[model samples]
Target: MPDYEPIVGRYLTIEVAGEACRIHVEEAGDGIPLVCLHTAGSDARQYRHLMCDPAITDHYRVIAFDMPWHGKSNPPVGWRDREYSLTTELYKDTIMAFCRAMELRHPVIMGCSMGGRVVLHLALEQADRFRAVIALEGADRLEPYYELDWLHRPDIHGGEVCAAIVSAQVAPQSPDEYRWETLWSYMQGGPGIFKGDLYFYWYDGHFDDRSPLIDTDKCPVYLLSGEYDSSCTPERTAATASRIAGAKATVMEGIGHFPMSENPALFRTYILPVLDEIRGAG
Candidate 1:
C-alpha cells in the first residue's frame, strides 16, 4: 500500500443571488457536473474529501460553495445589521441561481440536513433541470423544531452551543476521528446562523404529506439516512421514498447524521453504487 495524496481544490468567488458573495468554491475532475450542498452553518469545506478524491472527481465535475454568510464568503449588503436567517424561498433560489450562473447542465445534486430538506423542493419543483438528486439524512418534513431563544444571549456562544446539540446526535459507533471532524463545523459557524437555519430545517421546511409531488420520471431521487439519525430516521426516509414513484431509500449502517464528513470512507461505500446507477441512467 502507498500513501494517497489529494489534488488541491480551488478557492474562487462566484456571483449568486444578486450579490457579490465572495464564496469558497471547489472544483475537480471532469465528466458530468455534480454540485454539492452543505449542511447549515457548515461550509463547502465539508466536501474537501469529495473534491479531492479522484474516485468521485474522476467521474464528475464536483463543485461545492459556501453560502454568503458562511465559510470564507462575505456577507451580502445589509447583512451586518441583522441576524442571518435562511428561508425556503431564498434557499431554493440561491441553489437554482448557482447552477444557472455556473452553467452546470443537468448536474447531479447532493445535500445533507438543511441542504437535504431543500433538495426535495428542487426535485419537486424542477426535476427537468437536474439529472438526479441524492439527499443524505433527508426527509419530506423535518419536525420537532427546537427553540433556542437564548442562542443570542450575551453569555452564550451559539455556535458552540449548537455544536453541543449536534454532538449528542453523532452516532456512538462512528470513529473518534470522524466524530470530531463532523462536530468541528458546528463550532465554526457565524453567530446565530445555525439557529436561523433550523427555522427552515425543523420548521418551515415541512412538505406535509406531499412527497408524491416528487417525480422520479424527470429526475431520479435517492434518499439515504444514517442508521442512527434520530432527527430523520431511516424509517421516516423510507416512508417518504415510498410515496414518490421510482424513488429509492437506504439506511447506511454504523453512521448517523452528517454521514459524508462523519465517515467519508464508510459513506463512500454506500454512494458508489448510486453513482454507477446515475451513470447508467445517462
Candidate 2:
C-alpha cells in the first residue's frame, strides 16, 4: 500500500491572459525550481506525497496547478474550443503564461500522463524555458493504441461508462481513494470539456512530426513507465527518449499505468534520483 498524505496548502488565484485561475501552490525548500503537473482529470494535489518528500522538496521549490475546468479552477469561456482546455496546445500556452504570472524562473518540469504531453509540447515550443522534463505515462502520439480506440467506441456505451466512472469518482472511500476519485471526477466534466478532450485525443495531428518538439542538444529529458502499463510501453517510451538528444527512460518494477498513484514509493525512488542528478549538473 502506498503511504498517503493529503496536502494542506493555500490557494492563489493568478491572472493568465486576463483570466483568473485558482491554483494550489505550496512553497517547499529552496534550490532549483520544480513544477509538478498532473495527468488529465486530476488536480495539482496528485503530487502531494512527492511535494512533501524531503528528498525532493528539500532541494527544490515545488509548485503544481489544477488545469482549468478541473479541481478548483474555473473553465475558460471558450471551453469548447477544439483544443482541450485542461491539456492541449492552448493549455500549454497558458502554462507559460501562468509561470510568467508567478515570476518563476526556468524550472525542471515533471508531468504525468496528459501533463507529460503538455510538458513535451512546451519543450518543443520553447526548449530554453525548461532545463529538463520528466514524463510519466505520457505519450508523444495521440492515438497510442490502435485496437482499443479509447476515445470512440460506439459499441461500448460511452454514456453509461462515463456515468459509472463519474459516480465512483464522486464517492471515494478514503483519502487515497478520494485522490483517485477526484481525478475521475475531473474527467467527467461538462459535455464541452469532455468532448473537446476526446476530439484532441483521437485526431490531434500535432505529434505527427516529433523532431521539432524534442530538443536535440539543449533540454535533458527522462521518461518513466510502469512495467504493466498498457497505455504506454517501455519500448515506445525508450524510443521516444532515444530521439531526444540527452534523454533516458525506465519502467517501474511491478506497476501499471498510474505509477505515481499506485506505487508512489517506487515512483519517488526512481524519479528523485534523476531530479538530483539534473540539479547537481545544473
Candidate 3:
C-alpha cells in the first residue's frame, strides 16, 4: 500500500466583497475546530505538520485554507481588472465569511505573520465568534523594512527576489530541508501577491492604538514570536501582548518568522502547551 497522510484537501466557493472566490482548504484530525491562517505570500501548506500530528489531531480539528490568489486558491472574478491589494476589511471579511460558511462555531483561530496580525483584529471585533486567538510572529504595526515596489518590479525575478528576501528571516538552527521548504513557498507566490499581502501587514493592520481595546476576558489572546524574526520582533509581540489585558506572550527560542514551516518540531514545543491551555479552558 502506498504511504498516505490523513490530510484532506478541498475547494470551497465563497463570495467576498461582491466577487466569487474559490478557496483551497486542507484539514485533518477531529475535535474542536482549530482554524489556522498562513503567513503572507504563503498558503495552508504551512500548517501541514500541525494537521498531520496525531498529538494535536486527537484533540483538535486543524483546518487551514489558502486565501484567494495564493496556493491553489484562485483569485476572484475580474482579478486582472485591478491590482490585488489585501486590506484590513477584506482580510477580516474573508476570514469571517469562511468561518460562517463552514459553520465553525467558536473555533480556536490561529495565525502566523500576516495571519498573525489579523487575529488581533478578529479578537477586537469578533471576540464572541472565537473561543480563543493565537498569533505567531504578529505585532500591532510593523515598520517598513523592504521596498514593496521591488517585489513586483519589471526587472526583478519576483520568485527569486521573494525567496531570497525571506530566507534571512528563517533561523540559522532550523533544519536545512524545512528551511528551504519554507522559502520554496515564497518563491511560488503569484507576482505581486506577496507585495499585496504586505500592504495589510505593514499598513492596513495597524493595532498600536486598537490592541489595548481587546478584552481577554471575552476572548483570550496568546502570542508567540520567534526570537530570530526581525520583521515582527519578539519585543513588538510582547509589547502588543502587554497592552491587551490578560493576553500572554512568549518568545520561542531558536526559531524564526516562519516557525510552523521552518521548524515544525521545535515550534511544537512552544505551541503544545498553549493548545493544552486552550483545551483545558474549553
Candidate 4:
C-alpha cells in the first residue's frame, strides 16, 4: 500500500556450514545500524513500511534481508527431507554468517514471528555480536494449539492453521490483499522450499526449552507482543521473556501478529521509539 522508491537491494552469497545460501541486504537511513530479520516464508518486503518511514531512517540505518528459500532467494531443487531438521539451525547459521561476512558487530537485532525465533537463537548462540534483541510475537515453543497431538494431526497444515489464526487477529481492514500476497510469495518459493519448511515445522523440536541457552544478563532482550496475536499469545510470550534475566515484555494493545503490516502508523509510533531507545543505550 505504501509507495517506495524502486531501490535495488543487494544480493550476496554466504556459505552456512557447507550449503551455499543467498541473502539480500538493503542498507538505508542513517545513524546506528539495525538489522531486521523477516518472518518465515516472508521476505524483506515485510519491513517495507518501516523502510519507507523517514522517522526511523532519520535516526538509524535499516538493513533487512531475505533468507535462502524465501523471496528472491532460490531453494534447493528436488530437495527432500531425510532426518535433518531445517528449522532453527539453517536460519541461525545464515544470520550469524551474514553478520560475519558484512562485519556487523554488535547490531541491534529485531525480528517478528519466525524471525523473532531466529533472533532468539542468535542471542543464545552469539550474544556478543548483538547489543540488544527484540523478539516480537515470538516464543520458544510452537503454538500449543498447532502442536496439539502433532503425531495424530496429519489433517492439519501448520501454514494454513497459522494463516487462519492470524486472520482472526486483524479486524476492520480485510486481509484480501495480505492473503493474496502471502500465497503468491509462498508459492513462489516452489515445492521444494515448501516441503523443507513444512517438514521442519512438522518434525523439528527446535522450540523446546531454549531458555537455558539464553543469556539475558549479557544481552538485553525484549519480547514484544500484539494483544490479539493468535499464534503466540501475549501471556505465552511474556512468560518466555520473564524466564530470562532482565528481559522486558510488553503487550501491544489493539493489534495483531503482524502489527507492522496491519497498522504501520501505530508501529512507527509505538515500536520505532523502542529501537531509538535501544540505539541511544547502545
Candidate 5:
C-alpha cells in the first residue's frame, strides 16, 4: 500500500473575461468553503500545508487554484496575440466566476501578496458574495521597490531574477527547505507572467481611495502580515486595515512575505486563530 495525501487535484474549464480558460484546482477537507488565492507568479501549491492540515480541513474545505498562465493552468486561447497584464477588473472577475462555477455559497476567501490586495477589492465590491476574507501580506498600496521592467527583460533570465528578488523577502528564520521551495515556485513561472502579475501588484490594485469605502460590517476583513515582509510591510497592512471600519490586522513574527510557503509552522500559529474566529462567527 502507498501512503497518499488527502488532497485532490483537478482541472476546470471556465470562461473568464470572454476567454475560455482551463484552470488547475486542488482541494482538501470538507465544510464551509475556504477559497485560497496564491501569490503572483506562484500557484496553488503554496497552500499544500494548509490543505494537508487535518486541523483546518476538519472544519473547512480548503480550495486553491492556479490562475491561468501560472502553475499547471493553461493560458487562454490566442496567447501570442497580446501581452498579459493583470487588471483589478480581470482579477476580481476571475475570482467571481470561479466561485459561481463551483457553486460556493459565501465561501471564506484568503489571499497572499497580490492575491492579498485583491481580497480588499472584493471586500469592498463583492462583500455580499463572501462570508469573510483573510489578506496575508497585503496592503492598499505598495511603493515600487524594484524595477518591474527587469522581470521580463530578454537580457535577464526571468526565472533567476524573480527567484533572486523574492529570496530576500523570505525571513532568515524560515527553514531552508521551505524557503528554497518557495523560491523554486518563482523560478517556474512562465515568461512575462511575473511581470504581468506585478502590473496589478504595483499599480492597478492600490486601494488608497477605495479602501475607506469598504463596509466590513457586510463582510469581515482580517489582514495579516509577516514581520519580515519588506514589500508589503506590516505597517502598510496595519495602515490599510485602519482605513476600514471593523477590519482586524495582525503581524506574524519570524515570518516573511510568503508565510504559507516560506514558514508554514509559524504562519499557522497566527492563521489558526483567525480561522477559528471565522468558524466561530459562522
Candidate 6:
C-alpha cells in the first residue's frame, strides 16, 4: 500500500506583499527545495501528498504555503478594503518576498491553476532565480472566460458555484471520496476572491502572443495538463509549451483541474517521472 502518513511543519508568520501573514507550511526530507504553490483562492494543503510521500521527500525539501487571504493566512488590512485584484505584479512580488523570507535558494517551483499560470512571468523575467518550474493546468491564456456575477448576488451562496465549477472540471473517474477535499479551498474562498483571481487567470496574467518574453535559456519549463480540464485543455497547454523553445509538455490521462488533489497517488505516477528527469539533469 502507498504511504499515507501525514507530514508536519510550522505555521509561521512571514512578511509577504508588505503584510505579516501567517502561512501554513509543511515539509519532509532534505535536498533541493521544492516550493509548491496552490491554485487561485486555494491554499498549500493541496500538496499534502507530495509533502508526505517518503519517496519524494527523501530527496526534496517540499514547502507549501497558503497565500495571504487564501487559507489559514491572515489577509492584510489592505486586502480587506476590497482591493482583491491579483495582478501579475502582486503575484511575483509576493513570491520573491516570500522566498527572501524563507531563505530558499535555487528551488524548483511547482504550481497548479493560478499558481501554475503566474509563474510564467517568473520564468521569463527572473529565470536565474530557480532551477526550473512545473506548471499544471497552465496555458498562455485560459479561454471560455467566465462571468461570475451570480456569485456576488445578495442571496446566492457563492461556495456552491465554486463546487459546481470544480465538479465540472474534475474527471468522473477521479476518486469520488477525494472530490470534497479538492473543493475545500474554493468553498472557503473569500467573497469575490475567486472571481478576482479569475480576472488574472483569464486576462492580466495571460501570456498569449507574448512568446518573445520567455527565456527558457535560463530556467527549464515543464507544462502538465489534465485530460479532464476543460478550462485549460491539453492541446492549449501543449501549444503554449511549444511556443517556448525548451519547454516540455505532457497530458495526465484520467485527471482533471486539481491534479495533485484530485488524487495524489495517481498524480504522482506522472509527477515522479518529471522530477526524476529533473534530478537526472542535475
List the pairs of residues colliding in candidate 6.
none
Candidate 3 residue-wise lDDT, 183-206, digit = tens: 999999999999999999998889
Local distance difference test, per candidate? 0.81, 0.63, 0.94, 0.67, 0.93, 0.81
Alpha-carbon runs more than 4 Å astray in model 4: 1-7, 77-85, 144-166, 169-189, 192-208
Per residue, candidate 1 scores C-alpha lDDT tens digits across 1-282 of: 667445344444555556666556767778989888888778887787776777787898888888778877777778878787788887888888778768888899999888887888888888888899999888887667467575556798877787888886678888888788877888888888887777788777886466697878888999989999988888889877878888889999988888888888888899888888998898
For candidate 1, report its TM-score.
0.93
Give a tens-digit lDDT track for model 5, residues 1-282: 779899999999999999999999999999989999999988999999999999899999999999989999999999988898999999999999999989999999999999999999999899999999999998989998777889898999999999999898899999999999999999999998989999999999889789999898899999999999998898898789889889999988899999999999888889999999999987
RMSD of each: 2.5, 5.6, 0.7, 4.3, 0.8, 2.5
Residue 76 miss distance in model 1 (angstroms): 0.8
TM-score of 6: 0.93
Model 3 clash pairs? none
Which residue pairs overlap in candidate 2's backbone? 124-213
**Tens-digit per-residue lDDT, 100-208, candidate 6:** 8789998889989988887777788778998888898888887745676765556877777777776887888788877788886678887777777777787788886
lDDT over C-alpha atoms for residue 267 of model 2: 71
Candidate 4 lDDT trough over 10 residues, lowest sum:
144-153
Compared with the true structure, what per-residue lDDT tens digits does model 4 show for residues 1-282? 778663348988888878776667776777666788766555777677777787887776778888776777655343345322356667677778888887886788888877776677777777888888888777666633443233223575544544444456553342556544543444344333434453443345255477656887777788888887776688778777766767788888776767666666666667776887787785
Model 5 CA deviation exceeding 4 Å by range = none
What TM-score, computed on C-alpha atoms, does each candidate reach? 0.93, 0.77, 0.99, 0.81, 0.99, 0.93
Residue 147 error, candidate 3, Å: 1.2
Total backbone clashes of model 4?
0
For model 6, state the Cα shift of residue 103 in Å.
Answer: 0.3
